[model samples]
Every structure is written in C-alpha cells, then in structure tokens.
Target: MKQVILDRIRAALADRPGPVAVPREYRRDLGGTDIVELFAERAADYRATVTRVSTVDIAGAVAGALRDRGARRIVVPAGFPDAWLAGADVEPLRDDPPLSYAALDAADGVVSGCAVAIALTGTIILDAGPAQGRRALTLLPDYHLCVVRTDQIVGSVPEALSRLDPTRPQTWISGPSATSDIELNRVEGVHGPRTLDILIL
Candidate 1:
C-alpha cells in the first residue's frame, strides 16, 4: 500500500516545473567603514568585553586583563605566543600531555587566538589554528580570553568563511554561552564559557 501511494504521488508530480534560478546578490564588502572599530562595537554590544591595544602593548594588556578578571590559572593553548604571557600574574597550564575535563573546568580561563572574526555578526571563528586548541579547551572553561588581531577581522560571514579551513574543526563563539528558560530567565555558562573577553590588537 505504501509503495502504491508513493507511485501515485510520483506520477502526480512528474510534470513539475524545472529548477528556478534564484538571485544571490548578497553584500560581501563592508564598504569604506572601519571593520576593526565596527567589530569592537558589535562585539561589545553582545556583552563581550572588548579591549583595543597595540602590538607593543599586547603583553601588558593581556596581563592586565587577566589580572582584572582575577585569573590565577590560565590554560594556554598550543602555539600561543609566549610574549603575550610574559606579564601575566598567573600559572599557565599548557595542554602538552592533554588535560582532563575536570582540570579545564577548574582553570580560571582559557586564552588563545582566533582564525577569523566576523564584524557584522560579532562572531569569533576558531579553527584550532595557531594558539588555538581542541574544541573542548574553550568549551569546558568558565571564561575565555581570545586575542584577535586587527588584520584577522573580516567584514561579513562570507568573508570570514572564505578564510577558514573546512577540514579542521571550527568553533564559532559570539559573546558568552547563554540560554534563556521558558520564563525568559537568562542563564550563562550552559554550553560554553560564561564570560568571553576579546583583545583586539
């Protein structure tokens, strides 16, 4: 009976029209606007703390940010710049032998670099690239401090997607991990870090 019904439906739709061409002229360029400034503004609108600094002040800025957040044990992902951690007044944990989830959860926060950042949507794209670690490293930690260079900021999602490697794992983070209950009660740190700090240099 099922096959008979399927045959009838197929026969009925056999005279359907051909594929239609849809226009996909989406905006890709950010125009003459400042992407870096726009990214900072949009990211801050999501409640993620945004700090702007120069390359020379990265070390000081990083240390200051960590100290401000009272981070004692920071998880330093593989390939993270050592100079950035110079002035940090905290114990850095390197995931050389692989750290357990419990340790990651207990850490003050995780610090790393991002592959690309979307200015329009204020999203941070992580592909486990240099200074970035496994997906779990950012997920388990309560706080995440991501350092993004100005050159890494892209105008739109398409632009950001073009810079990513599909084969490698990717984690897209916007602000902090949060969700609302049926009553509209907000909750943080449910799926990922409760707090997200962005350092733009």
Candidate 2:
C-alpha cells in the first residue's frame, strides 16, 4: 500500500519538467594548499581529537587514544584489523554476532576505518566497508576512534562523492554528533558519540 502511493507520486513527477542541471558554483580551487594540514585543522575545529601518526605507529596511537579515554571494551567491527588493537589493553568486542543495543551502549568506544574524508568540510564518510561495520556500531557507542589515511582525504565534497559507491549505505560525519537546537544550549552525544578521536595515518 505504501509502495502504491510512492509509485503514484513518482509517476506524477516523471513528466514534471525536464531534469535540471545543478550549477557548480562552489569553490574547487585549492591552490597548492596542504590538504592534510587543512583537514586536520578543520576537523580539530569541530572538537575532534585529531592525531597525525606514521603508519608504523598506528597501533600505538590507537592504543593510546583508547587508553586516554579509559575505553576498556572497544567495539571491534568486522574486518577491523586485529593488529590495530594489539597494543590496546581493552577487550575487543566483535559485531559478528550482532551485539544488543545495551551492549553497544555500554561499550567504551568504537574504532574503525573510513571510506573517504572531505578535507574542505572536515567530514568523514563511512560505507559499511570492510573496516567499517554496520551503522549501529559507530552510533550506539559513546566514543569513536576513526582511522583516516592520507590517501583517502579529498579536497572537495564532489570529489569525495564521486569516489564512493552510490549503492552502499553511507554516513557522512563532520564531527561528533552535536546540536544547539534544544533551548539553544550546545549539547553533544545526543545523537552520536560525544567524543570523536581521529587517527590520521
């Protein structure tokens, strides 16, 4: 029944004017600016803890970030590397069996890799890729430790969008979830993790 109404709406709009072309007026001219530096600066402005680390020290960095947050039970999404969690003293909670919401909420944090990150907006995109698990894994936890490689950072939103698979479930996060709508008082963790730790490797 719901499908019938949607089909009727689509049929009504099918002939409603021609497809419109969107203007590309946004700035794309990043004249030799260091994107990584820009991304880190912008992400930090969003209150995310951004740490730049070499590939060799990624495991240590991840461990330290979790330790700093006192995250004892970290959600280990499927396909997340075991090597990355090697130095961390936390219990690795896998999503293979699909943990309950209570379990996810009780966990200290989550650590996963991103599909792409937009340097212009300081946004990270996840697509439930091998490193990224289901959307719930990242959302239910109080903290998130994201892994963003230098190569995955794009200069513009269009560039980032073009690189992603449209069929996949995508989550675009500019920072830890926040809002100032309720009584205009700024609040964090209302929608997502309160603390977002970014590991830029």
Candidate 3:
C-alpha cells in the first residue's frame, strides 16, 4: 500500500512541469577584506571567545586556554593532533567509539578541529572530520575548544559549503549552545556546550 501511494505520487509529479531555476547573482567575494579578521570579529560578536595564535604557539595557546577554564579531564577525539595538547596539564581521554553520556557529562571539556568556518556568519562546520569525533563527544561536554586554520576560513557561506561534503554528518555551530524558550529567558548550555573557545591559527 505504501509503495502504491508513492508510485501514484511519483507518477503525478512526473507529468507536472519542472520548477524554474533562480539566477545566482549574489556576491561571492568579500571585497578583499581579511577573512580571518572578519571571522574573529563575527565570532566574538556571537559571544564566543576567539584567540589568534601563530602555528608555532598553538600548543601553548591551547594549554593556556584550558588552564584558564580550569579543565581537568579533557576529551580528545581519535586522530586529534597530539602536539596541540602537549602543553596542557590534564588527562586526555581518547574517544574511539565516543564516550557514554555520563562519561561525557563528567568530562571538563572537549577539543577538536573544524572542517570549515564561515566568516560572514561566524559559523563552524564539523563534518565529523579527523580530529572531530562523533557528535556526542562535542554535544555532551560543557566546554569546547575548537581549532580553526586560517586557510579553512572562507569569505561567505557558499564558499564554505563548497568545501564541505554533503554526504557527511555535519554540525553547524554559530556559537555556544543556547536557547531562549522558557518565559523568554535566555539560557546557555541547554542542549550542548556552554563555553566555546576558538583557537584561530
């Protein structure tokens, strides 16, 4: 019965005219503005703390950020760069199959690298890439430290989308998890990480 209904719907649509194509006239370039700087500014505007560091000092920066947040039990995804956490004074738990909800909740923080970042919207797209583990690893933790390379920063959303794979599991985060649902009161960490720190290299 389900297949018969679907076949009828498909046959009906097959006889209808196709939809019109919209013109693509939007600007793709960012007028020569520095995307990294724009991304930092937009990210900060979203209440996320952005820290710019040189590639050589990324380890130190990550360490310092984790130290300041007082993170003790850090969750590290599989294939995450070891050098980035070398200076951190904390026990790193590797997420091979991803940790349980209770374990993730108990963790102080999670660290990973994003697939691509959009400057215009100040958004980070995670396709569960190398350092980025399963979605649960990032969603359950209270704090998240994400590393974004300069080259991964794009001028517009279209540019970022072009760099991402549609078939992959993707998480698009504009800022820390938040919701203003109850009584119109704003709240953070309602569903995901409360604190988001981005290390731009």
lDDT of candidate 2 vs native? 0.91
Q: Can you write out model 2's per-residue Cα lDDT over 1-201, one digit (the tens) per residue?
A: 999999998999986987799998887646688889999999998989999999789889999999999999999888888888888899989987899999999999999999999888999999999889999999998999999999999888878888999999999999888889999998866769999999899
Which runs of model 3 end up more than 4 angstroms from their true locations?
Answer: 1-16
Q: Give the per-residue lDDT of model 1 (tens digit) for 13-118.
A: 8999866897869998799989999999999988899999998999999999899888989999999999999988989988989999899989999999999999
lDDT of 3 by residue, 71-185 (tens): 9899999878999998999999887565788999999999999999999989988999898988888888899999999998999988987888999999999988878899999
In candidate 2 the C-alpha lDDT for residue 37 amounts to 90
The candidate scoring highest on TM-score is: 3
Candidate 3 lDDT? 0.91
Candidate 2: give the clashing pairs. none
Per-model TM against the reference: 0.89, 0.88, 0.91
Candidate models: Cα lDDT each: 0.90, 0.91, 0.91
Total clashes in model 1, counting residue pairs 3 or more apart in sequence or in different chains: 0
Off by over 4 Å in 2: 1-26
